[model samples]
Target: MDGRKSLGNHFEGVAARYLTSRGIRILERNVYNRGGEIDLIGQENDTLVFFEVRYRGEGSLATPAESVTFPKQRRLLKAASYYLHRHGLWNCNSRIDVVAISPGTVKKYRVQWIKNAIQAGF
Candidate 1:
């Protein structure tokens, strides 16, 4: 894969491990559908979560979470909606989440989990 994609995949894995450590059960990764791409899909308690993984290295202009803009949120919403519908999960409880990763001073990387970061009806 290209450099950017490779880097993204690496961070997605990082996010996966981080979430798993926190009790989120990952069901899928790198999911592509008609709407857009979902970086990770998992279950947190009874909620089905669609995760958007964002990464920004040092000196980047935007924080990893800030990079998920309005347009991106719309896409994620659509993608998540499609995912829920495709699997007969229209009534399943779900939400879009974000896992923002960046370089850290205290550790190798800083990870932030933002629950329900993207909402529907956008």
Candidate 2:
């Protein structure tokens, strides 16, 4: 794979492990639909979560979470909608989440989990 894709996969793995440690059961990864790509899908309690994993190395202009712009949020919403419809889960509890990763001053990496990060109306 190319450097960018490889780096993204690495970060996704990091996010997956982090979520698993927190008791979230990962259902899928790298899901592609007509709308866009979903980095991770997991079950946390009774909610189905769509995760967008982002990474910004040291000196990047934008933080990892800030990089998920409005347009990206729209696509994610569309993709998540399609996923729910396809799986007959339209009535279930679901939300879009973000996993932001970056270099930390003390630890090797800093991970931030933002719940309900993308609203559907966007």
TM-scores for the candidates: 0.97, 0.96
lDDT of 2: 0.95
RMSD values for the candidates in order, in angstroms, are: 1.2, 1.3
lDDT of 1 by residue, 1-122 (tens): 99999999999999999999999999999999998999999998888999999999989999999999999998999998888888989877898999999999999999999998987842
Model 1: residues with Cα > 4 Å off, grouped in runs:
none
Residue pairs in clash, model 2: none
lDDT by candidate, in order shown: 0.93, 0.95
lDDT tens readout by residue for model 2, 1-122: 99999999999999999999999999999999998899999999999999999999988999999999999998999999999998999889999999999998898899999999998832
Error of 1 at 112 (Å): 0.7
- Model 2: CA > 4 A from native: none
